[model samples]
Target: MPAASITIIFSPYHVGLRNHRVGDGPNRIRALGLIPQLEALGVTVHIDEIPPVDDFEGEIGRSFEVLRRTSLAVSKARDGNSFPFILSGNCMASVGAACGLGIKDLNFIYFDAHDDMDTPSTNENGYFDAMGLSMLAGKSWHWHTEQIPGYAPMNYKDRFLYVGLRDVNETQRKTVAEAGADVIWGDAGKAVDFPGELEKRLDKRDMSPSLVHLDLDVLDKSVGMVNGFESEGGLQEEDVMRCMSLLPKKATPVSFTMCSFNPNLGDGDKIAGIGIRAAVAFVEALIATSVVSVQQ
Candidate 1:
């Protein structure tokens, strides 16, 4: 059974700027009636937004502030027994959500076109979001992560699984291999048994309720560019939903976070609609397969 209520936390900042670039995605998705749709699924909905940084902190400072705020909001929602759902412009917010879940040892099912395991030393572009997974895995950025409340890096090697990884650099590829993380490559142009693939690697006994992070760029460019980082040979909308639906069998999805969407890209409304459908599908699937109910 689903929680009696769900809290949606919106962090609408892209690289620290409010409503800028992909930062606009969170509000855009909400504007598309995501709340009503989720409520129609029979759960009370509470809304929360991460406030913008009052000062002109550098991207690093502002971004960490956003994560800190997200951590607190998600933590509050969890304390109230509400399932927390997050929408953010950058994938880094997953770390905040995980920390807020109050689980020191956690598993993650990540969907993205890129590996997101780059370190400052390895990332030539200096893209901070690229280091999200590395930070969560305790590989880089130790200085800042320690400041966030309730954060402890995990031995996330086998605990993490990657789906739709087709666009990546050699550094990212090497990191994935060295970490021994399981992956499902996207460019393999054939019908994939997503559940069968996941089941083969995931040991249910070792799993608990886990977080599901969706970087919209995991969708194929043919599905309309979800963001500037979208690549070819990605999954279709149905493929994403199918994969999400299977998660409950292996590990119940206690929380879901959708990130890295840029409404400025091709056909913003169309792309947001896909995200809306995905959110609804994820919630509905959770409801269908829910084995425990937490009343608020």
Candidate 2:
């Protein structure tokens, strides 16, 4: 592993509320020893917190503010040639992280339980988080999304990889299909080769920096529930660790993020520990990949 440094940008806000519900997950996971574990490997790790806003805006206003702050932090980290690691309450932070890394020609690898593809008109539940992937694909929320610093709607084409989908609605399924994304369903009855699928897609494209985003709810309930939205048939812990190790082999991951963890829920500490371990695994994979690159 080459000598490297990382900047961890954590947002302890869920839907713009500080330490509310899932917002606590980031701090909790960090407290669980994510930083010390990385430092043990002799990796330099810097910590940055998203500044809490004084004005009381609604969820929509606050959420975008969080994203804007996140983008700035991410850009600063990348400017220093440090890897950006985001720990946020909402998976939508991926937009800010990607934009900060410069969105032009950037590829995305998404791991989530839900499709997160509902548009404003299509989302009956009125859940803002559900529309994250849709916004990334430039399918919805044009006005608000444009407000986010460094944010531009993502170009899906062949550069998008959606994995561990098991609880998507019909509308989300249709939306994802129309985008022509490569998907690996979590509920497939047959065995899955996570690395093989990732490599196959990566082989089709020129090597470019990628953002790897993991929503903790992608883990199965049996592994310990990560949030209220967790369902029965999601990926197991071993499956997630294996995928984390293999993703860096083909994709040059410039940034990594884990979101959608609600520590207020049952067994929060257990899930936080799992998330911390996965994060450590990802950094180790990055180190190993970098060493191999240097060797060649």
Candidate 3:
């Protein structure tokens, strides 16, 4: 009943957060609830860890390695009949999965409260987790900037889209502008009606596959629960759903990531359960779209 075996990898690595909390945050978050719902929806959960951190190049190297491993795991998951697989991870783990998927000239539909666009040297601290996007774009340390070879790195070019970003640094703005990418602010008041919007927007830019990464913080801290570094001027759950509704028909193997769920949303069980349900709905919607295409 578990969708013929889906690899639900829980990345326990917390290589990014400057402020630390529970040592078993990953396990605790998982236990709060997700397994039962996913199983009931016909999904098998395969929990596992990535290769240990390396010391030579510090955390960044380990981070890159994990991305590559995630890619490998994803590839294996996709073998034979392609069932919708799920991956739950932290910040840098998201980076690894992006690398794992060979997205050339990729368009990133990044939904988060922050830009995650800070270059390493530019960051006040030498934290790889904080600078995942910058390094992916080949914009950071010469060594760490390398993405999986031949894979399209996460450049801010025509390939980037930021939704629900109400807080950011100046460097991120300049970088985003340099790439001429589009950024959508998540104001609760403004309605997102821009004239057949998404199509008009995508039609105006490059035509390629996309990587959609949704950081849990995009939702108001009240609705989704337990996010990393909560911010003001947040997006409502409906707004987030509206954004998800715009996923196109032709985007190949669309990759979606739900990241940095801090497990602090009030009534942990309800919060985590609903969060998992929302995530699963997104995936289920993706598969249903495939069915719609077949019938049409």
Q: Which candidate is the best by lDDT?
A: 1
lDDT of 1 by residue, 1-296 (tens): 35667889988888889988888998889999999998887767898888888584799898888888888998998888788899998889998998888786677888888888888888877789888877877788898888777788867666778888889877778888898777877774665555566676565345566888989998888888677877877888888877766777668777789988889876788889889988887777777776324233
Error of 2 at 122 (Å): 0.9
Which has the better lDDT: candidate 2, or candidate 3? 2
Per-prediction count of colliding residue pairs? 0, 0, 4
User: Candidate 2, which ten residues in sequence have the lowest lDDT sum?
Assistant: 287-296
Over 4 Å off in model 2, which ranges?
A: 1-3, 54-56, 188-196, 199-207, 291-296
- State the displacement of the C-alpha of residue 284, model 1, in Å, after optimal TM-score superposition: 0.7
Residues 1-296, candidate 2, lDDT per residue (tens digit)? 34258889988888888888888889889888889987776678889899886475799888888888888999998777778899998888887897788768888888888878888889887778888777766788778778777877777777778777778777778878888777877764555555566667677775457888999988877788687887766777887887888788777888899999888778889988889888878888888887222112
List the lowest-lDDT window of 10 residues for candidate 1: 287-296
lDDT (Cα) of model 1: 0.81
Ranking by TM-score: 1, 2, 3
Better by lDDT, candidate 3 or 1: 1
* All candidates: TM-score: 0.93, 0.92, 0.77
Alpha-carbon runs more than 4 Å astray in model 3: 1-5, 16-29, 42-48, 51-58, 80-89, 125-127, 145-154, 188-208, 222-225, 245-253, 264-271, 291-296
lDDT of 2: 0.80
